[model samples]
Target: MNRATLLTLGVTMLAPLGSAYAADDVKVVEKPIRVLAGIFSAASGANKQRTAIGVGYDFMKTAATNPTVYGVFLDYNSKKVAGVTTSLTGVGISGRFYLESANAAGKPYATLGVGSYTLKAGTSQSKIGGKLGIGYELNNGWLGELSSTMIQKIGGKDPGGVTFGIGYRF
Candidate 1:
């Protein structure tokens, strides 16, 4: 082979090795715990649309391509409806399945949870409920999500609503 051709072949063969070494030098740090605080806007169903404050804690390591996060959340809202003071509170444990790598710039996830919810309007009743949700998380530790919760029948009416939330993970 000519010197020029040999040099070209050598460079081409070495380029990938150089890139592989560079990739090995790049380390990805994983954060296993995330704390979140946000707002929840209840969807209209058995109750009027109301906004509530929510807090959550998630335990998941970002080293996996698809990580299942275990989390717990609490939400509370109080408002007057038809001249009656009403309050709703929910506490739940959830499992979130991530669609992509947690280290990805924008990751999508689906969640399922079960919990007990209490509604107080003149009287108070507690019911077992389930929730389903989808969320998008950004690389900067911010996330936006929407969920629907369905509580057991209370007074012949199912008290449940959709919730929207924005949170930060740290």
Candidate 2:
């Protein structure tokens, strides 16, 4: 090929490469408060599924390097045991690592938290445990999450359950 033709081809190919994307060009807004509400269910057994609706909130400082979340939540689990009504309530505080993608369209996160709870059977039983979950954070400040919680029982059984929920950041 001639040098003139080669030079023309190189310039055309390099022109597009000059327009590289920079993360600095994208604006990252920090939200002061994040609130979430969702439903939770625990896998007990046949005719024994614990259920609850919960609300959560997060207040923390944001860092460009590592996105973080700090929050607390409570759930009220009510079920029918032996044809009688029973209720279990739990509360916990957690911090999560929020990971944002390069495109900044969506964010993924993992969380770990610890707290105490109470169950009302024949008597009120108090227990302590930790919670874990993985979820997605949308650019629009909406989030979806799946979680597993484990709270030890008092003279009864293990009170661990799975939860799914949707939340928003403000």
How many backbone clashes does every candidate have?
1, 0
Candidate 2 residue pairs in clash (backbone atoms < 3 Å)? none
lDDT at 61, model 2: 28
What would the TM-scores of all predictions be? 0.70, 0.67
Candidate 1 whole-model C-alpha lDDT, 0 to 1? 0.66
**TM-score result, candidate 2:** 0.67
Checking candidate 1 for backbone clashes, the offending pairs are 43-162
Top model number, TM-score = 1
Poorest stretch of ten by lDDT in candidate 1 = 25-34
Candidate 1 residue lDDT tens string, 57-170: 763323346766665778676677678876778887666678998568999998776667898878999876766789998888888888877666677665677777787776
Scored by lDDT, the top model is 1
Cα deviation of 155, candidate 1, in Å: 0.5
RMSD of each: 17.4, 17.2
lDDT of each: 0.66, 0.62
Q: Model 2, range 18-66, lDDT digits (tens) per residue?
A: 3322322222346545555555565453334555666666644234455
